[model samples]
Target chain A: MFSWILLSDKKVHQAVADTVHAVTDSSAHAVAEHGAHGGDENLFTQLLHHIYDSKYLEIPFYHNPDPNKHGFELMQFEKWYGIDFSITKHVFFMWLASAVLILVLSWVARKNLKNRVPKGFGNLVEVFVVFVRDEIVLPNMGKGGLKYLPYLLTNFFFILVMNLLGLIPYGASATGNVSVTAGLAIIAFIMIQLSAIRAQGFGHYLAHLTGGVHWALWPIMIPIEVLGLFTKPFALCIRLFANMTGGHIVILALIGLIFVFKSLAVAPVSVTFALGIYMLELFVAFLQAYIFTMLTSLFMGLGMQMESHGHRH
Target chain B: MKNEENNAAGMIRSVAPYLTLGIQIAAAVVLFLFVGKYADDVLGTKPWLMVAGIVVGFAGGMIHFFREVVALSNKEEHERITKN
Candidate 1:
């Protein structure tokens, strides 16, 4: 236990030193470029550079000899119109997360269970699955929500793993990307709509949007109801994206303090605070993942249960 | 220590569902505000449409919010009663 503690302590020191080195070098570059880009523009550009998606894959333990160059260069694709469809850092991380999930989950799935729990990682996976079902899915969605379990489970794990990936060295958080969260929210929106349609039938679903009000009030109610439908998913997209990215920004800023002061004394204070935030971030990661899954189910439940529970607005 | 952590987590779990309610209310106004801006641009109306959007969106959002609260509370009460 002592050796393990010592080893981990050493690892943390190394990681923190490496991070400081990386940040200082980048800030140096940013400071150099500030003359050209305008001073204020480059102030947070170094911090933003780490958060924003890029065309390079930052590999851990593989340092570039040249200070100006870093990471393996990804494929550069020509833009079609103003939008570039080229593979970026976030996309690479997302694919890596998905591949890891598929491999590990399939391995867990193939495990035989006969009146006994599987060991190690399988057990951990089972805990999350059961937690999602009982605490998240079944609570809001109920027994009828079993059909949607697979998707909810996938969503929970995907977000959890992606959030965790961001905490690691040379790791980019795909969930921090607004577009990715928006895509997930879009899927959740479609699922919510589909759940309502399945529960209430297509005719009742249309009527529900009219809010069961008199025909005279239909015009006003329809637009409001439609907007409400979209607002939920839009909020979801922003919430996840903001929370994931915001934590990273705070951590980056906290570390950036060391460089900003140009003193070793600042390092102790900044590193300690950064470590505290990093621990809090670990909690936030799980919390955000849980919140996302919980809200998705809650929204779907609101739709599915309306037939039986709702007073038709 | 573990129980304390779980309790804190439970508190968060309970509070989280309602976070969306605030967002819904805010989003309604923002969504409509943008819609109104677009409409004003297209139809040659100025700030009037945007002002209308805020009023309409607020009222509409409030109604939706109250309905959701009632529905959710009703379910909770119903579940509590049935469980007993």
Candidate 2:
């Protein structure tokens, strides 16, 4: 009786193994037939493709015969004027952010004109505007910074909107792209240099490049000073890009844990962690926007003050 | 109270730039090294120019770093003195 029972248990175990093996083989064959280039893509690569910008945008409305293949059949434009001027999802998102900014700010302005005291959405926006003007601009740029109020305010709001929008389901963060952040940083850089030139005159601005070093040290000091000018904006670009990308990557990775283990048991834990990360990302979206704007204002203030000091000396 | 508040704000402002100091130094060095390497290729000086480039880039980056630190300290000191 003991031998018979042991044989029955062995037969049951073999049946389960055979079923699992057959299912796996069929799935693998189906995936190969569908022509998904990255066959049975592991969790990490899937997560990467989700977060990172791709050449073609996936269309939800379209259905491909092979479900394994991405519905990435969107038309791609060719190069323009010797540059790869292809429009990607990130570019569309940037344009969307800009359009939203214009519409919202205009509505707020119109509302403010009719009412002395802000109400509803206008009130909330006014609070941000006042904060940027008072806390960021006034403290850093002083009274003279008022002229730059529009520029700085635009930067803050635009970045904040872009960051917040990224947190929305199916929305990509434009600022997460290095190219976009670099573009913003370059604008800030130009403004800083321009402000310095305007404050100290052309000759004085050039003279300031000497970094107060003796003439003999100009060769070394000049290159370093010039490098300093670029490094500020470069840092600005990297900081914004890294911060935005880091949060999304973390959230995606956490969600990816469920698939990596290939077990339903991991879902509860993975999803819980992902939710926590998503909340942190929401906070980071605001914090990063504030930091980027504050740093830009501070850089402007520094340049203007340095030029003024040179004049005084 | 206002003086204390100002001091706190001043501290934040001064400390902010140091966040990027390491990156700045690295970028400066890398940028110079590349330029040096390119020049060496054109001028046929090879290793010598590249070495010189590394030295110059490093020294320049350090100088800029020190200058920024000094500037921040000076600003902080000036703020303190004016407040007092």
Candidate 3:
């Protein structure tokens, strides 16, 4: 049973095994001195706690139980980030995804740099990189946006990688977390504002608060425009966070239907919906990356235009 | 009444930018205040750091707003010169 559960991911199991060995070492010493092998009990109990109760367990959010076994169980968020944030399961997955992305991208990047025709994975990555730079970054952001292309490219690919990671069986999605999306949105917001400031001088930037209207109309229009700017990024954060989380929740709910109905009869129905949603999520993953990059570029263009106007008169 | 309407229209047009400025200032202030208040309560800070946060956020927002306006003006000037 333990070995089967650990089969979900080998590294996770090894890490758990290491932790299990560490905790059971002192206890194992006492148990061994007694000339009994019952230390297995202590090991088992520790493993169970780690699996079910410990913060370190990375249980799949969408789990369905067999009717042959004891019923269904819902994955709990409170158990993960709340009282048990120390659990390295989510953190480990995040690190693993990031490392794998960096290693793979770098490897592909180096191999394709020769002055010859690129093929295979190198070709795919190059096409993606160029498309984002030319299509997404350049058009919306205008010519001046080239300076910020690297950041936008990293953001898009990083998000794309993380989103695709969750699509892998048993892999957890980091992008589903509000904190992660909010952090990304906040960074984009900082970039947007800084670019604006850099283009326009100190005095003129504040003057934009009034929508570049003459002084007499400053009272009413300023607040609305200001709110508009802040709300744009706030909406971006919420949209990404909500969409990612909502998909996972729907999948979980669908699986739970079989357990609720107490029959395998629902499996056929549930699987169809699950597959359909799974496909939709793949598209959504790309759509979100595109939207975020496009918006950032658009904001950059607007800022540049504002800056150029500021110096005119 | 007609005079007041014209004044309101003129005010609407001119004060628009300042109003936006105030809003940007206010949003930054409110965001800081909300976060500071939450943190102070959660972290057990005495006297609540929200007041200081609001002041700091407002000042920062003003700086940001001024910078944006200047950038816009500069871009406009470049465009005009190119057109000529």
What is the per-candidate TM-score for chain B? 0.81, 0.78, 0.66
Error of 3 at A238 (Å): 0.6
Q: What is the CA-based DockQ of model 3?
A: 0.07
Q: Write the per-residue lDDT of candidate 2 for residues A99-151, one digit (tens) a residue.
A: 99999899999999899998999999999999899888888888999999999
Interface RMSD over true interface Cα atoms for each candidate = 5.0, 3.3, 11.4
* Higher-scoring candidate on TM-score, 1 or 2: 2
Model 1 chain A lowest lDDT segment of ten: A27-36
Calculate DockQ per candidate and list them.
0.29, 0.50, 0.07
TM-score of 2: 0.83
RMSD in Å for candidate 3, one decimal?
Answer: 14.6
Candidate 2 residue runs with Cα over 4 Å from true position: A1-42, A58-75, A311-313, B4-10, B17-25, B65-72
TM-score between candidate 1 chain A and the true chain A: 0.85
CAPRI class of candidate 2: medium
Query: What residue pairs clash in candidate 2, if any at all?
Result: none
Per-residue accuracy of model 3 over A1-313 as CA lDDT, tens digit each: 3553334333433443344334422222222222122223343333222222222333433223553321123333445544744434445556676797789888987889873677998898889889888766665556778888888888888778777776775455677777778888999888888888777766777766666556664543465456657775787788887877777666655643433333344557986897799899999988887777767766666666665443333
Off by over 4 Å in 3: A1-54, A59-88, A210-226, A309-313, B1-84
Model 2 lDDT tens row, B1-84: 253345645566767657667776777788889989999999999898899989988888887778767876776687688778
Compared with the true structure, all predictions reach lDDT values of: 0.77, 0.74, 0.61
> Mind listing the fnat for each candidate?
0.30, 0.52, 0.07
